[model samples]
Target: MLLCGLAAVVSACGEPAPRKTGGTGTARPGDRVTAASAVPVNGGVLVDLPGNAQLLVVQPRPGEFRAFNPSCPHVGSLVNPPAGGVITCPLHGSTFDPASGAVRKGPAASGLAEVAITLSGEDLVLA
Candidate 1:
């Protein structure tokens, strides 16, 4: 149908306007987490924030950290944190890379959404 085509075109064009920088249904910012508790050498660590924002924090390399909103681009379902660096959405089969928030597979046309993070001393603050 024409409606379906139009919807596909819109989604393929680009992402929706950036959601307010907070978590699900909230305008306030997220909380800070300790870096030592988040970044791991093997897989990722899931940190649940205020307003129901779940973040996956990964240590891709020594001294490097990355963070992403663990929500599937397809249906906004919560994505499983990476195991051996692969993030998977259980609701579907979409996969993402935690380090770069890049899409590793489809049914999800885009990557995972990045969450702002900054390091302060030994902690990572959700900005």
Candidate 2:
């Protein structure tokens, strides 16, 4: 019970930390993605996700864009997003919901921590 509360605290307080200028490929958990690679400058784009992995961009419906990290929280492996709205890790086969980032499989019983990014007046505030 106590551990669950602590886990909730750790997950809820998760925000990307500032990274040094110039990064490549993917971004990590608690990492602030800039306008270089996945992140966007001119238009809205990639945002940070949990588990130290780059959140893949997904626009299921018009006017709504969702971001999810390809990595499974159970292991450090990448996860694949299904068309229906679930993310499955190729390594351990753990599944997570794209909307909530919650673990729907065993071994990774805990829910995946989701990062928040809101579009505030034409600006995507990831902080």
Candidate 3:
């Protein structure tokens, strides 16, 4: 499991990290996030948004994608990307479902916030 996480990180090092937008406004609908191919099948990638926000974009299956705020509801810590079918918070051991962002286990009483996204050709656009 640790190897998987490390592999994900190492692989991402070759891709362009999400560019930090200078605007203070929150990401709007129709904004381009990242290429769909950047998200691996049954895995995820972290994307940086304008207002210091972030999204965890996961592909639970080929041709289907889901996005989440990736913030642990317990204390607002950033959760790790899905591994072994679970999205986990490193700070407090909160676990969320990769596909639905539902709480699987938690000190958190709530689940990760879902963010809508749409695939535009090869791009994943915020929706």
Q: lDDT of all predictions, in order shown?
A: 0.72, 0.51, 0.85
lDDT of 2: 0.51
Put down candidate 3 lDDT per residue, 15-108, tens digits, no spaces.
Answer: 6755342221388999988899899998999887777667899999998998888778898878888999999999989999998999999799
Quote the positional error of residue 46 for candidate 3 in Å. 0.5
Name the top TM-score candidate: 3
Off by over 4 Å in 2: 1-53, 58-66, 120-125
Q: By TM-score, how accurate is candidate 2? A: 0.48
CA RMSD, predictions in order: 11.6, 14.4, 11.0
Better of 2 and 3 by TM-score: 3
Ranking by TM-score: 3, 1, 2
lDDT tens string, model 2, 17-41?
7542111234333344433333322
Tens digit of per-residue lDDT, candidate 1, span 1-127: 9999999998898966444222433423445754655677656777765554556777777776777877788988878767766888898899887679899998999998786776777888766
